[model samples]
Target: MDLALYHPAAGYYTRNRTVIGPRGDYFTSPSATPLFGRLLARQLMDFREEMGYPAGFAVVELGGHRGQLRQDVLLEAPDLAYQVVEVGDPLPAGLVGCFLSNEFWDALPVHRVRVAEGRWQEIYVREEGERFADEMGPLSDPRLEAYLDGLPVAWMEGYETTLNLQAQEWMVQLGQCLERGFVLSIDYGFEREEYFSPHRPKGTLRCYHRHTLHDDYYAHPGEQDLTAHVDFSALIEAGRQAGLEPTLFTDQGRYLVGIGQELFAEIAERTAGQFSRERQAIHQLIHPSLMGSAFKVLIQKKTS
Candidate 1:
């Protein structure tokens, strides 16, 4: 999965910046509106002030492609130092400020697992001839095996799920990087209760191609986009283990609305002249039936 998405060359993210937006496989929140970043900037400024207004403040953005969020955030608060953290690039070393990402955690590779024959097992991917195939085998990775030892998921037969082992590791790294700051993640997912619910027997692994969604991860391999819903509950626990404090966990709709309704109206008028397209996009970002309820935001802060 890492080879398909971050192989340094010919990978999905490294080569396909154009594979986003309305014509692409998916449209992230930042790609939809600058309002998202502006709202973030407002909250960030408050966070910085709330932390006693440090002199050397910085905002670091993770998985920022072509610096869209950076651009939007900078446009609002240009005087604030902004940096984008991409693959093979070092995050602001020991920086004191905000670490943010939009739809970032879901893109990372995950280990697929299942329960069969009343025993836990791992779904290993192997190449057969010119294509890849899945073969069930005993859980080899001890980390994943240990992670699920006491999770909320019921031990039902044939229940499938994914574990993003790297997410927690990265959180640890981020915790060490920021002496004092906020860690913000925005993506589509649910807490442990809903994420591991019984209804989603097949798990959240999915593929996207030309705006169509598919469940087959082996299709087109490096040609299509693969994603899994983030387990926010796991993320919160991991952050706490790394010594970070959880501040807020909520959906994107409440996030935008929590900022203020008047600011949203001003952004709609200032950012878009036609008003029709931007209005629809804003609705999609905040309306529950659209991206609102589907996407959630997590905030973790480190102080002291």
Candidate 2:
């Protein structure tokens, strides 16, 4: 998965083939509307104010493709400091502000696992005459077993899931670099129970190609996008271990509504004409049936 998505050459993201927005393979909240970033910027502003606007404070965004969110937020809060970092880039040290991300954690490479004979087995990819095939093997790493310790009790035979150990490392990295600030992450995920529920036996790993969703992980090797839903409970626990405190955990819809209800109302009143496109865009962002319910928001804070 890492090589398919991050290989320096012939990879999806590294090859710069990731197209976002209307014509892209998929749409994110920032792609839906600037209001998304605007509302988030408002929250960041509050974070800044609460922290007394510390020196060298900056809003560091992880995997911010094309900077749409950065542009939108800067437009809303012109004086706010902002920085965009790619997935593998070295994060700026001693950051005094927020580490923000949208749909970023889901894109990290994951270890596929399944319950086989009441034990966890890792899924590996092998070459089959120019095609890829899944090959089951023992836990690739002891960390995989440790990370998923005790979670397979209810998983029946053949139940498949993904282990996103990278996300946990990400939290620890953010905790290490952030001297005193918050981490605001927005992505599609679940709160552990739902993530590992019996009802979701198939797990959340999915692929996106030309805006179409499928589970053909082996199709279009380095061209299609692969993702999985995040486990917010795991993230919270990881953050706590890394010296960060969870401050908020909610769906994107509720978070946006809490921060932008009045702003949305004013924008609706002002953009009643041709500019009403933004109003519709905002609806797509917060409407439960759209990207709103599908995405979640998690905020964690750390102090020096």
Q: What is the lDDT of candidate 1?
A: 0.85
RMSD values for the candidates in order, in angstroms, are: 2.2, 1.6
Q: Could you tell me which 10 consecutive residues in candidate 2 have the lowest summed lDDT? A: 146-155
lDDT scores of the candidates, listed in order:
0.85, 0.88
Worst 10 residues of 1 by lDDT: 272-281
Off by over 4 Å in 1: 151-154, 265-275
lDDT (Cα, tens digit) per residue for candidate 1, span 199-293: 98899999998889999898876777999999998888888887788899998999878974778678577776664765776788899999888
TM-score of model number 1: 0.94
Clashing pairs in model 2, backbone N/Cα/C closer than 3 A: none
Candidate 2: tens digits of C-alpha lDDT, residues 154-211: 3589888998999998899899889999999999999987898887888999999899
Q: Supply the TM-score for candidate 2.
A: 0.96
What is candidate 2's CA lDDT for residue 193?
79
